[model samples]
Target: MNIVLFGATGNIGKVILQEALDRGHHVTAIVRDPAKLSVQNPNLKVATGDLLRPASYEASLAGADAAIASVNDPDPDNVPKQAQVLLDTLAKAGVKRFAWVGGAGSLEVAPGVRVIDDPNFPPAWKPSAMGMVKALDVFRASKADIDWTFISPAAHIEPGERTGKYRVGGDQLLVDAQGNSHISQADYAIGLLDRLEKGDAARKRITLAY
Candidate 1:
């Protein structure tokens, strides 16, 4: 498959790039600076573009079998706008399958309650978390002709081993025996790729954790 990706320099995006290449898929990455993407693979191509301006990378999406975005706006307030731009541009580019690396804040921790609503939710993370929450809302309400899937990572995601062992859930946050919700970046990439290949969660949000 020819896959187009945004935010290829990010922690999660880079991992996704590697995973796609390892599977022998043709990947075209759209980046603000191509130099940041150090991965070298015969299947990988880098395109210089801006996330806020779709025309900058609009051509890259053409003929793409699927488009994945792991973008996080440097400005927390702009996340939703950036997300909308990617969605609209992909629609215009005629890509049918779209996968988004979303946030866990919007996942329900209990009936009618989200993680961001918890009193213990850190203030520092609230802005970005809410931005992702808004992005999810945009995807849900949009009427675009696309098969969109939003995968929310666990509350704690960082550089770690790719055990490729984890669990999946819908809407609700997944937790382990110790009541912890976390997943390694490597495993998260595997989960996202799995969804892209399976096409099981059309127009729905899925959560990953272990």
Candidate 2:
């Protein structure tokens, strides 16, 4: 499969890029700074562009089998709009398969309540989390023919070893017996690329955690 990936330089994006390549798929990574990506493979192609300027990268999406977007913004204000632009561009390009990296905060911890709404939720993470929540809604409300998948990571995602194993869940938060939610960045990438390759969780919001 020929995959077009956005945000190839990000923490998660880097792992996703490697996962795609390791799966023997052709990957075209679209990023602002090509130098940030160190992967060198015949199947890997790096393109320079910004997500805000979709027209410049339209060609990158052409003939692509699927697109995995991992774009993020520190400013909560810009995240939703940035996600909208990418979705709209893909729609216009007639790309039918899409997968978005989502936030755990939007996942319901209880009926009519979300993690983001919790009083103890960190103020520093709210903006980015809320942005992902809004982006998930944007994709859900789209009228396009695209088959979108929103993959949300666990509440505690950090650099860790990829055990090449993890559990998958739906809207409810996935927590261990110790009452902690966590997933290795490597395993998260593995899960995301696994879904991308298998087309699992199409038009759905799925999550990965230990």
Candidate 3:
């Protein structure tokens, strides 16, 4: 598959990039600074582009199979703004498939109780989390015929073991026997690739945990 990736230097984005290359898929890593990307692979091509500017990366979208965005702009608030632009750009390119690396905030802890609504939710992360929520709304409300999937990570995601194991759920938070919702960065990327390849969670929001 010819995959176009955004935010290839981020925590989750880097892992996902490696996973895609490991799977033998042709990938184009779109970034502002090509120098920041150190990975060199025959299947990898780095493209210089800005997410908000369609013309910057639209050329790279030609003949693409799908695009995945693990997007985190300098201003987290720009997530929603870029989302619309991204959809428009994809439509113009005739790329109907997209996958977004989503946040846990929007997942329901209980009926009508989102992770962001939890009293224990950190205030420091609210701004970015809310930005993800608005971006999600943009995806949901879009009239374009894009087959998009939003993959939300567990509540506590960080560098840890890959384990190559995980569980999946929709909208609601998934927890283990210990009642903790967590997934390693590696496993989260693994899940995203699995979802993309398997096409099991297309055009919907799904959470990953273990």
Candidate 4:
């Protein structure tokens, strides 16, 4: 498969790029600066471009089997805009399949209560969380024929050893026997790649955790 990946230098994006390459897929990593991407492989190509300006990298999206975006911004307000550009770019480029590295805040903890609505939700993270929620809304409201899949990680995600093992869920948050929701960054990458390869979760949002 040929894949075009955005945010190739981000924490999760880098891992996803590696995961794709290890699977023998040809990956074109789009980044603002090519030097920032340290990975070099026969199957990997780094393209210089900007996410907000899809025209800068529209050629890279064409003829790609799938596109995955792990790009994130500290300012939550900007994420949705980036998502909008991504969708428009992919649509214009004629790439029908896409996978977005989503935020967990939109996942429901109850019938109508989202994880971001919980009182215990960190105040500092609210903006970013809500930003992701808005991004999901943008995707849901889109009328394009793109087979878009959004994968939100566990409540807590950080760098950790990749066990290549984790559980999956939809809409609702996935918790372990101890009621804990978390997953390592490496394993989360594994889950994202699995979703891309299977294409079973298209046009839906799924969560991954322990």
Alpha-carbon lDDT, every model:
0.91, 0.88, 0.91, 0.90
Candidate 1 structure quality by residue, lDDT tens digits, 105-204: 9999999999999999999999899999999988988888889999999989999999989898999999999999999999999999999988888899
Model 3, residue 187: C-alpha shift (Å): 1.1
TM agreement with the true structure for every prediction: 0.97, 0.95, 0.97, 0.96
Q: List candidate 3 stretches off by more than 4 Å.
A: none
Model 3, position 58: C-alpha lDDT score: 89
Backbone collisions counted per model: 0, 0, 0, 0
Model 3: lDDT of residue 106: 97
Ranking by lDDT: 1, 3, 4, 2
State the lDDT at 161 in candidate 1: 96
Can you write out model 4's per-residue Cα lDDT over 1-210, one digit (the tens) per residue?
899999889988988898899999999999999988888799998899988887789888878989999977877888999888888888777887899999999999999999999999999989988899999999999877688998999999999999989998999999999999999998999999898888889899899999
Residue 107, model 3: Cα distance from true site in angstroms? 0.5
The lowest-lDDT stretch of 10 consecutive residues in candidate 1 is 74-83
Tally clashing residue pairs in candidate 1.
0
Q: At residue 166, give the lDDT of candidate 2.
A: 89
Estimate, for each residue in 53-101, the C-alpha lDDT of model 3 and write its tens digit: 8889989999988889998876888999888888778877888678899
Which scores better on lDDT, 2 or 4?
A: 4
| Residues 77-145 of candidate 2: C-alpha lDDT, one tens digit per residue | 777787778778887888878889888999888998999999999998888888888888887887767
